[model samples]
Target chain A: MELLNRAISGTMESSDIMVEIIPWDKDLEINLKSDVKEQYGKQIIALVKAILDENGVKKACINLKDKGALDFVISARVKTALYRAARRSQ
Target chain B: MFDNFSKKYIYSQNTRGRKTTSDFLKTLGLSFDENVNITINILDGKRIIATASAEKNLIKCIGVDENYRSKGLMNTLISEIISHQYDNNIYDLSIITKIENEKVIQSLGFETICETENIILMENNKNKFKKYLENISKNKVANEQSSAIVMNLNPITKGHMYLIEKASKESEQVYIFIVSEDKSKVPFETRVKLAKESTKFLKNVKIIEGGDYIISSKTFPTYFSKNVDEWINNYCNLDLKLFGKYIAKELNIRKRYVGKEPYCELTSFYNKKMKEILPLYNIQVTEIERLEKNQKAISASLVRKLAEEGNISQIKELVPEATYKYYISKED
Candidate 1:
């Protein structure tokens, strides 16, 4: 799916990660900032990559500000942001 | 998330907004900044708990309710502000945050550009300052004496041309940084075009668009919690410190040239302050006498005054061909 305008989802609240997706020309670049980066950084990045790959998103710059969110919550926010990016501005 | 947490975008036109914002900031030991364009308050029903305000692209006056600390509220606060700015097509944003809150802001994707004893300057995109220097690095010439001159050039005049011409003769290479702020009678684009057209003949000169790093008195806030004189001193010194530390080092500008101001007290004071401050970073300030016509110093302000009177002949004598043609066309 082609990402349209820059879309943002979720909040900075605890147990939630704010996801910002902007169209990039080159490739999918995920910039993650998480409190649990030392422990779950790889897993969180891998999950974001898998989700973008599944959606056939070829190019994007996804910025994630994580405050110890669970995997399900992270996936939901990224999916929502990607979904919003696909739609025209409302 | 905190219960009943609702954010309000305070418009500049709202009158009661001032009292409420000041009351909220007073609790945090900070005061309301009057220069804010858009201010957002995270309210708990009737009371303001957290707030942040932006003056154009520079975010200042950030205060969160003390009781709300360490609760991930900043994430919501900053992301909202960042997204708000994105909607306006302003991606590169800066914040003049207090020195204490540096780490927290850095965690929220703001890279520190430079920090003083009190304030830390940060931006959203990292390595942008580096990139600004690198873009100009292409013009960097190997020279024993490379000098820099910063000018507003509201309208390029013979005085400005004479200064650059003299600097070009003395130094191996010269850089003319056209001030980028928009507080001038003449627009930035026209000034730049005139500066280029007048000096296109000088082989040793390069004209650069002074970006945000070049802080002008008008664009910066005067809310440094110091007296007027102290704040002005600190402001000019800090601006020179940035130039000396970053720009001079990157471009090998060992000399900074300023035309002696016989009129504006502020310009003369800046020249004096530059002499005192820039040397600490190993850059020398050289003051030159302004070019004279009819035994009076030729100046942009003088040209502007003549233009106001529609004095074509007098304006023609003080300005270059490029500026004279522009003035004639503009007066038309």
Candidate 2:
């Protein structure tokens, strides 16, 4: 789905991730910040990419500030933000 | 210890929590921070434990109870503030914190833009500074003997023109960085336009927007508003150090220029502080006497007053042609 406007979901509280989506013209860009960068950064990025692909989202800038959120929480936030941001059908 | 806490997002529209938050901030050696449009407080069932706030793009008044250290509350506080700003579509946010409180803010993914002994300015967006350097460095000539001036230009005046002309005559290149903060009756865009149009004829003079680096005289960080007089010097030194450390080096600026203030003691003190500090960075400081008419220095504030009160021809002698045209057209 294509994004209509900028939408954001989630919070920066502990064990939660703040996800922000901006409509982009180029390739998909995911900026992830996590304290566990060495151990789980790749896994987190892969999960987000898969979620975006599952929802057919392309050309969106996703900003994630992860405070050690589990995989499921990350996926939920991304999908919710994407769904809210998606362009409507004619 | 962190088990029984609830967080509340308080803003101006619903100020139910402002008084408590203000008192809470006071106990932690920080003020309630006047003019903060958004604030978030972590409450221990009515007693405040931690809090943070933002006034537009700048964040201040972050405090967590001393007993609550190492429980991840600071991170939550900062992240909440970022999320608040993000919700407002403010992606580029920054905080001016004392050097002692540096680590907590840095841990929340803000990189230091510039740091001095007492003050450190940090920002969340990493790309802003990089792009600023790229844009300003485009005008960098081969010579390192370049000079720079950061001006507020409330409205470009003849005094400003004379100062820029002096720098143009002496320096290999002159960069005019128009201050970006919008606190004046004259909006930032109009000020920048006036500065540009007035200096269009100076051959080697280039105009650049000051962005987040150049601190304006209007924005004395509310972080240090508690000690008003003392922090003024600190703020001025902070700006000069930013020039000497990054901007001057990037543009090969070796000398800095200023218009001597015959009025406004605060600005006079700023000139005094610049002379004292810029020398330590090995950047020469030149103070040009104000351009005068009728034996009085032409002041930007007086012109703004005259323009607003329908005194167009009176200020004609004070401002340049570009600025005079702007005010005259507005009169009609």
Candidate 3:
């Protein structure tokens, strides 16, 4: 399903990632603002890209404001944001 | 002790290497806003001792190392930001800080405008904003039924013209504030010129600059943020609240005119928020249906697309004569 509107999930608090998804014309632009960018940035991006590819989100802008969130937290936040963007709970 | 301290502008790519600036912001419990345009960092031989950032007209995230506090580094940082803003033709500067740091900012000639329990909003040029309002009020011939429209006429189309004309006819005086942020494909100078020429026939309309207070990157950074939903609600609330509480009162504006947003979700959300919030301040929100052609809404984005494709014939139908002429001249 196409992303209908802009949506966000999670918060800026510790151990969580605030994921925001917005519609885009072409390509997926992933911007990550993380506290641990030097150590875990690449891993986080890979996880998010895998999730987007799985969900068939081809053209969208995804922004992750991460505060030391683990892979599981990142996955949950991205899933929630995508669901919210598509206007579906699941 | 301060001999090694050197001030420099922080570019986006260089931010990672500037650990001192990042550490300073982190210590103050402030996240480094990636949208920061002008940043002044005082480094003591690669150690960031003091730092301040100005997004547009609002200065924020100012922090100094505890070791350098009593030596007046904060004052220097604030002064530098002020000078930077002034150099950019931004006269109305504001800073939002915790109540504890209020006195420090106040010492640098900023006066408190509004205060909540946790934060205080101070401005360096409250008098300038007030004076601007007074000038508008004094010059307005029909102040009895005044209205306002804050718009970014990126490339003024017939839709913008329609809204402005409607507002001009309905109110005794209409203040058309062109958004001054230069983040558009069409430069601010060109947009302002096109808007002025397009609405020259409307006698009751007075065109002015929005002046960093309305829909600015400082208050509403959604325009730049790819994640439009993240901070839009909070920023829009703060922006509209500032308008309702201060700007509306100062200019005696009782009504605001906006175009109906049917395409962009962010704009639609902004309109909804305006309708819900403006009434409390007694400023009525009037959202006019957008002009359409061929069953499609006429928008600046459409005009831009047509221009990019070199479709002048179709572009002529969507834009006003002034915009058409401007585009034609640019083609030459």
Would candidate 3 be rated incorrect, acceptable, medium or high by CAPRI criteria? incorrect
Candidate 1 per-residue lDDT over residues B45-112, each given as its tens digit = 88888888877678877888888888667777787787777677666678876678898887777888
**Predictions in order: chain A TM-score:** 0.94, 0.91, 0.97
Compared with the true structure, what per-residue lDDT tens digits does model 2 show for residues A1-90? 768888777766678887888888989998888788789999999999998888788788888888788989998888888877874332
RMSD of each: 3.4, 3.3, 22.0
DockQ-sorted candidate list, best first:
1, 2, 3
Per-residue lDDT of model 3, residues B35-83, tens digit only: 6777888888877778888877878667787787777677567656765
Q: What residue pairs clash in candidate 2, if any at all?
A: A1-A56
Candidate number that wins on DockQ, 2 or 3: 2
> Best-fitting candidate, measured by lDDT?
1
Interface root-mean-square deviation, candidate 2? 2.4
**Highest DockQ against the true fold, candidate:** 1
CAPRI grade of model 2: acceptable
Per-residue error (Å), model 2, residue B71:
4.4
TM-score of chain A for candidate 2?
0.91
Superposed Cα deviation of residue B10, candidate 2 (Å): 4.3
Q: Which candidate would rank higher by lDDT, 1 or 3?
A: 1
Candidate 2 lDDT over B211-281, as tens digits, reads: 87787566666554467676777788788887787778888888989988877788788888888888888
Off by over 4 Å in 2: A4-7, A21-32, A57-63, A87-90, B1-24, B32-35, B44-49, B65-71, B141-144, B225-230
